[model samples]
Target chain A: MTSADQVPFDDRGLAYGDGVFETVLLRDGVPLLWPYHRARLLRGCRVLGLEPPDDAALAATWQAPASGLEVLKIILTRGSGGRGYALPESPAPRLLSRRTPFAPAASRWQGVDVCLCTLRLARQPALAGIKHLNRLENVLARQEWQRADIAEGLLADSDGNLVEATAMNVFWLADGVFRTPPLDACGVAGTLRAALLEQGVVGEAPLSVETLLDSELIEQLFVGNSVQGVWPVNTLTTPDGEPLRRFSPTSASPLQAAAHRLLGYVPLSGPSLSGEKR
Target chain B: MTSADQVPFDDRGLAYGDGVFETVLLRDGVPLLWPYHRARLLRGCRVLGLEPPDDAALAATWQAPASGLEVLKIILTRGSGGRGYALPESPAPRLLSRRTPFAPAASRWQGVDVCLCTLRLARQPALAGIKHLNRLENVLARQEWQRADIAEGLLADSDGNLVEATAMNVFWLADGVFRTPPLDACGVAGTLRAALLEQGVVGEAPLSVETLLDSELIEQLFVGNSVQGVWPVNTLTTPDGEPLRRFSPTSASPLQAAAHRLLGYVPLSGPSLSGEKR
Candidate 1:
């Protein structure tokens, strides 16, 4: 509950990033998409050969005397054991959860400017899709801009393959089909994207920047994550700040309509800015 | 300083590994090779766009009541603000320094065994050679073995280019010359390795496992870091506990001898096992 009680200098999570974390939106003391976060956390544990902890207990401990709207962040680490990278004999998982209260963030990606980050994401299939803590690539990419005008920066894999934004998964509509980049290479498969795919609203495809920018068949672009749902993307800019291309929903995109119509709780149109508040 | 007064859950270092750390071996209340760690820490800050903290003040605080044979660990994070990957405006660097009492480790790789990890390191030139906190690769590689017989695990890049052991830079004595893997792609450039290079004891060369095993021109193999100087590698094995090759110093390795004799304080021939203690 307090800073001193949460972490220590010997924490393997801080020492070697031997951990995974999930940020779930809390609606009246309940974490939305609890199942997905729990699954991902367990998968991360399996990858690092750590035992899974009871996250339900952790959520309860975090939401005691909870408020209306807050973010419940659950971090499961290899605990304060292990000499270097090798897991300690009989390793127990360390669970650190917190609640940061905030107003519900509104969707405001329509007509926003995004730049292609000069920095590329390294291809690490071992760490791909499971949200582990070794996130220097995302950190460095997000640091590429501090302007109030830029909404986000698109990142590409080492082979110039379009991956995702720094903090969100990307989706684009083309030929009346909804396509998103496959997370087989390197990108966190966010819960919103998974939900969209499972509900027959979005499909997976290998996306390249060239194909997205050059194809006239592309109709609309959007990005989203579990915490912040879908928001339509409009503009793409080069690293030089030159306008690369502009896109909009040419027609009433069935996918967008289905996304909002099917997932009623997901906000699609609202006024908000990008930063800590969002 | 104790866990009661150390890192918080909201610290970016724990949340994102958005920080850098230095593990300097303390000799009787003195941090050895202080300059290299300082330079690397500052350089890491630059790469992450974090302002350099006054490490001198941190050192003073750490050594105020220092004792014999310990490791002084310093962590500099883009302190507790910011949401997601973006750096907070006018960020202040948070400094966390701790004295971990440790007995000086000695090199015992004369007839030791090391495994070649199946997990390959991804090439990230931007983060290559910097001791950033994003170390999932090393953690995964190290988890390949738990047996006391295994000394360390060798890691190669995705392209099969030999990079380093889990925590040390490797030096190979082949063709009657000293050569080390080019760390322009992946692997941490440790201070001891850098010092050996600066002292004209090691040179850069791209090595592959095939070359090291097949070519009879190869002779001695050694690995090192600041805390543990030069360790002579003996046998190599595959990840599934299969023998790849058995090797020893074909003759007296000049590199190893110089690492000990030339550098007065480097404990080269001492009998200290590698693991969390080292």
Candidate 2:
């Protein structure tokens, strides 16, 4: 069925969030960093005990838009007909694809303000790192802010460790080393975050709000995901919009530039790369 | 739309588990403990920031089967259209209803075997008690066993405090008092459990697996939900199927009988009740 087709009412994804999804960046007619997305999707299927999608079906679904930058969301649910949370003996997994127009503002790449969310994520190690459909925690965190200027909200696990943004992975340059939170306990391991880690551009480290607000230690901060490359954190604020700290919106750091390159993001003006301009 | 109809592709419920649901037990043409279910559903809507379903619409959806006991599942989603987790400008919530035949064996009312799931639920107090759709933990916990004989799987929070069964709230008679685990940390506050608490038949208390296995302190164990009424726990086993403890199966205790009465469950042959026979 096409992406616009209605899903069965009894689908477990709608009932119990029994599904996983991937948001891929499609520039022009090509999907960026698809291998990583595919791997994560497979891992999610394995974790949820769902059968992997057929290669041909997945390829057909990933057909990118003819042109322009867009967001392609792929949702794979354990298809309908299971008794409550119980799995069906012979499962038919449904794959849905939808593409939406996306135009990231050029100014956002330079810097964006973020706020700390009051809703702390639960430490669910079993469901962590997989982009499953059970995203009520993120929904609640996103609801904490309503300002048009606030680009995202940062979340922490119940233990007070800084985890991730509502829709992105977080990274900071501290003591001349780039680091991000480890996702062993909670947080979605974004594809962009994985690429940075794989390229040895970012290291995993436990961070807290105290460490993040410490201007003396943290030199720079940024948030990123597969859909939107990386947006430098210009200022950090509390849920009440009280400014906690402000980082200068300087030129992209060497590590941030590296991350941008890995994500196939070419800055609008600064550096030259072989890709479509934003 | 009827339950057999398809849900729209963009439904937030399918996309992000942004919804809540209620399972009402319908005996003949009457819904048992509906007020409790309605209150919980509205509470869930408030917790998730969704518009509550219209009373008339809800009443129409809850039309019970003509005869016999059946499960009436009502799902209320935050409707379609949202930019990621951001709230829609004007929300249009969707309410869906479905019914399935339910036939709980009379023997189960006497006693049933249960097992401990290795999966520990993450403690998220913000989403605790309200039965929203983010239930991957329950799905994973249910996957811990495939044996049909194991009626339910008991779960504990990461802190080692017993929470609830995968699909039912748990209670035990300890020192001549009925107590259940508090849902402030995690676990769904079931409708039947609410009824028992409201009726002053059961109290909330922290419970541990060790305490449950203790034969001297714990006199009897039982599990209940809106759908299945109550079933006595005859045996508790480890994930590996090793017998942890066994309690003698006697006729329904006073608390059990009270819970049954509150749930409008009438035993097939035991005590007389002013309700349709199961």
Candidate 3:
């Protein structure tokens, strides 16, 4: 928050939002799941025309860092390009490492109530899946809800295909199969989502909003990000505040317990809300 | 460009590309088409949920002391909000006024060569026309060509709709009618494009790439922005460098003359390349 941490006026990340970033959760001074994050950051660099980072330099930087339950972040920018959108011939990509307290709302750990955002994510294959700096869509989606009880916003594409929660990957259980929307056209392929999928804990399904509204087939809903691991969803509502579905935390849900065990974490839980119980 | 001119590291504009900007072409120390650019900037503010700028303060600031034939830019951002995408409860919007030298590549003023960009503009109706900071698509498209000869890159939507050049609005004299793409789904509605349209010098048309590629019907091509007023396109090529069409600059083209007269500028001409003689 100090003035010393400011970026230059011509910084491309500021002017054109030309950059990529990674949010790493630190536990005992070690960045959790760093390999996956590093890989994604590197891929973002190549795709955005920024020179890839040096692994040795990055490893030394990551290892040499200091204390507390802080959230560690790395931002890579194609430096300043003034007002233009074109990349400079010799771009000096700025590699910034910043540390901030990992103090997200405590309520986030105890499940969340999400509303379907009116603003749908644009299908951009070129920018999809990478943690790039252009995140106005998330901001717009999050802006839709202001109540403390509503923790996150769920987004879909223009075609009504389910995308993700504002900052987390979303999944639902339907007929005992964990169904998560494919993010090839849009949405971030979140690290936690990747880990769960790689561990054979979840499967991809093309779930549209209409399909998700069918409460009969769906069993459970959960959303997750690295910062919060995974949290069960308590309810889903339409934009006009109509409750489409309500989910209660249950130890009996095999996927819920399985996800926690596989990720070596506990699923976030809150008091059950009213809905047609399974 | 200096250390003093830098922005905060946590600037929502930098962290999330949560900002909007306007470029005003300055001639003889006065910004050309200020009203139009100012209108667009205010509209961007309303759309992005930032407080509207004080008109009196803005007018006073604009009338304050300044010099040079430079490009005047105004950047409005909802300050820094740390790592989150949510707007701060009490947002402090930063208004930046900067002047950069008006020295674009000389080749830009003359009839320029363009090629189809491999990247497609993702159709986000939420962000179609207004120039927000999330411009990775334009950066990626402009990166498609490194040749000094290629002045700009033409972009299309996922459905083969011709959007616009990477940095300018485009219009073509098709079948004796001035036709330009309707920017409903994507593309920045450049200030010059608006002026020309408002003046009845051009008409909106839903142009697809196939329509533009049909060279027989189109008589002339022009691309423009506030920084560089309208300039004709001399050649067009596919992304893979196969020649799609070659346009000739002719004094005989009435619409070309009309655009120049309407904009109060002369059409830039370079040594004619191999094309039909005028």
Using TM-score as the measure, which candidate wins? Answer: 2
**After aligning candidate 1 to the native by TM-score, how far in Å is the CA of B143 from where it should be?**
0.7
Deviation of model 3 at A175, angstroms: 2.3
Best by DockQ: 2
Clashing pairs in 3: none
Off by over 4 Å in 2: A1-4, A268-278, B1-4, B268-278
Error of 3 at B272 (Å): 11
Q: Alpha carbon lDDT of residue A67, candidate 2?
A: 84
Tens digits of per-residue lDDT, candidate 2, A1-49, equal: 2233568778888899999998988888577888899999999999999
Clashing pairs in 1: none
Q: Please give the lDDT score at residue A95 for candidate 1.
A: 77
Which regions of candidate 3 fall more than 4 Å away from where they truly are?
Answer: A1-4, A56-68, A103-110, A251-278, B1-4, B56-68, B103-110, B251-278
TM-score of each: 0.91, 0.94, 0.90
Report lDDT (CA) for all predictions. Answer: 0.74, 0.83, 0.75
Model 3, B63-97: lDDT tens digits are: 65566557777777888663388788677777777
Candidate that beats the other on TM-score, 2 or 3, i.e. the better one: 2
Error of 2 at B106 (Å): 2.4
lDDT of 2: 0.83
- The DockQ values of the predictions, listed in order, are 0.69, 0.81, 0.75
Candidate chain B TM-scores, in order: 0.88, 0.92, 0.87
Docking class of 2: high
